[model samples]
Target: MTNPEYWYNTRTGEVEKGRQSAWTDVMGPYPTQEAARNALKTAAQRNENFDAAEEAWEDEWDDS
Candidate 1:
């Protein structure tokens, strides 16, 4: 099993990802990508999408 990871958006404070037909960002930090996908949960929906654009980015930078 894969250790599920959650990403938070820094721009709109909404986590965004690709859904079936379009993108969505309703409830973030979803347990699984499939959950996020179903609700269309994505950072872009809140108009805060970007390349690795998330509060977690800082952590990634720190690790590097």
Candidate 2:
């Protein structure tokens, strides 16, 4: 199968195809343009949830 054709340029918040910039400045191999466009928001949401979960876990440990 071929690789995904869409990417999210984290540095510029642009949805594009192939490599438009350095690998470190982008985040995707998203299969659809819309998914690439929402990459940063999605990442932020996931990070927030993860941090919340980590905080809860730490609180549980602290109460032990």
Candidate 3:
């Protein structure tokens, strides 16, 4: 199989192609290095979206 084109190293906050460390230290199969580097930001944005959606659902349920 082919190696990943990009990876985000959460431990060191670095983006690189190919393997750098074990799975425990990495987090990506992102299409580009820029995307890999922004992994945390992307995750935060998704988390915010999920939280907002949950809050909205709760509000709707409470209105019923």
TM values, all candidates: 0.24, 0.83, 0.83
Lowest lDDT 10-residue stretch of candidate 1: 17-26
Report the C-alpha displacement of residue 61, candidate 2, in angstroms.
0.3
lDDT of 3 by residue, 1-64 (tens): 8646888998998997976778998887788888999999998999999999999999999999
Q: What is the lDDT of candidate 1?
A: 0.48
**1-64 in candidate 2: lDDT tens per residue?**
7765788988888888876888998898888899899998889999999999999999999999
TM-score of 1: 0.24
lDDT of each: 0.48, 0.88, 0.88
Q: Using lDDT as the measure, name the better of candidate 1 and candidate 3.
A: 3
User: Which RMSD does model 3 reach against the true structure?
Assistant: 2.0
Tens-place lDDT digits, model 1, residues 1-64: 7556443444344444422222242355567655555434444555455444675797789899
Quality of model 2 by C-alpha lDDT: 0.88
Q: Please give the lDDT score for candidate 3.
A: 0.88
